[model samples]
Target: MLNPFSIEGEWFKGNLHLHTTGSDGKVTPQEAITSYAAHGYDFLAITDHRQVTEIDGLDHKGMLMIPGIEMDGGQTDLNGSYHMVAMGAKGPMSYDSGWSAQELIDYGNENAEFVFIAHPYWLSLTLADMIDLEGYIGLEVYNTTCHYGVGRGDSGPHWDDLLARGKRLYGFGVDDAHFGYADAWVGYTMVKAEKCEYDDIIAAMKAGNFYASNGPTISNLQCDGNKMLVECSPCWEIRVVCPLPGRGTTTYRSGHKPPFTEVEFEIREGTDPIRIECIDEVGNKAWSNPMWLSE
Candidate 1:
């Protein structure tokens, strides 16, 4: 059987964070999906803060709505501002002052569910505690609402450092939708699954079989335990870098536009660990941490 990480020529694009009238947004659940689906989105997780968008008659009805919620955490005033994502999950998971944010994260992870450190570099929540949490599955590198909210240079450093440690951390980009005002479809996930379906997409996400982006689109990407292969449209260059252990490194670059001319590189065993990056014409970058085969 084919697995989630196995690329079979299928790609999924959708937003994970969004808000409806249930929270702070203006539109209702139906209107939110209506607008996004028309924009060519394949999937969407309607994450109303502290409130899960109830799909009374709309479960898997029109567009693909992956059930999810944004659990608010952190201290009262300090650096306690944090947001966490519970994807393909149903809850009862609400934000409360009595329970710490980290505790909610633990609950999600312990249940074998998908949890992403929402906008690690945004708002009052930095990449502080998320680094220490072993149960964390992924981190949001680009959050639409907070992309320009706080500033740039939020997730790049943290992701780099984690990659340096040879940790197979996955990166995700989300709209963190508070409504139409935040550009709900701003961020999307690229899956390496066989085709488009609910279970397949969810499985891909859980297996780290995808990459996150705000604008760029990835057509095909593959790695076969040695050389890495990538094909994308509407881009300029392909940059492949492996974040080796001990602060070491390895990198490969190829200049090929659409039609995706080929770019090949070698990775030696004792030459530090590795990762791959895709750089667009405007200098925008999509990165993937090295998938280590050895210690």
Candidate 2:
């Protein structure tokens, strides 16, 4: 197991997925950045439609704005649907008519980019199958912009399954903030990066150093070789859950209400994938993706 202190060092907070006027979104990239900046988000990705914008000189004050694009290939089906997000890549990506989800993932992988399966539950795409590919970097656990009952359930299970299979897949919760009927900033992927820089934040996210949230904020989290240590809002009940290697879940629940609540649990070795979820006093909860250990 890795040292606990190093895991907590210099973790930055950010939102990896969002939409703007470059696509079907109502707000412009600048407007979206402004709103998120005011809300204390350190990084934001403007992933517009099938097109990637060239916001070369655009600046978001101290905040980092990453250029990205969302793509669609083939049609939606009960077993499989296709929509993807590619980040940190230059020039046009392949938009072939005869492309499968795995084909798209291969193209992204060869070009060295980040690939995220968007709104899996909403689209009802067989995410478990797509996750089998090593190139498929991440999955969206919660898409706040989508209709409430559109997809399967929350994406937490999708991420858990990937970890259960011993895959180091990352999880992302996006606002998909189109600024439409749904309220903007409802869901966000909180990244635990080394710094607020572009590469650091992206690297952390690609490595699954993140948690998804609607409103609640997580202050501190630590997982030693044996004990998982977490601290969060005292006003709500907190649940720390980890997917055990044998297809079961290890959970610890604690309730408190101010200064800080410390929760700990002993986890089995080799079942290193862990997630921390904060349930607010009113029952609203936010979840972090599985933080994988052992490289």
Q: Determine which window of 10 residues in candidate 1 has minimal summed lDDT.
A: 247-256
Error of 1 at 12 (Å): 2.1
TM-score of each: 0.81, 0.83
How many pairs in model 2 have backbone atoms within 3 A of each other, for residues 3 or more apart or on separate chains, i.e. clashes? 4
159 in model 2: Cα distance from truth in Å? 1.8
Q: How large is the C-alpha RMSD of every model relative to the true structure?
A: 3.8, 3.4
Please give, for residues 141-193, the per-residue lDDT of candidate 1 as tens digits.
77777764545423756676676665557778777766645556667776776
How well does model 1 score by local distance difference test?
0.64
Which model scores highest in TM-score?
2
> What residue runs in model 1 are displaced by over 4 Å at the alpha carbon?
1-6, 59-61, 76-78, 110-112, 124-128, 180-182, 222-226, 245-261, 268-273, 293-295
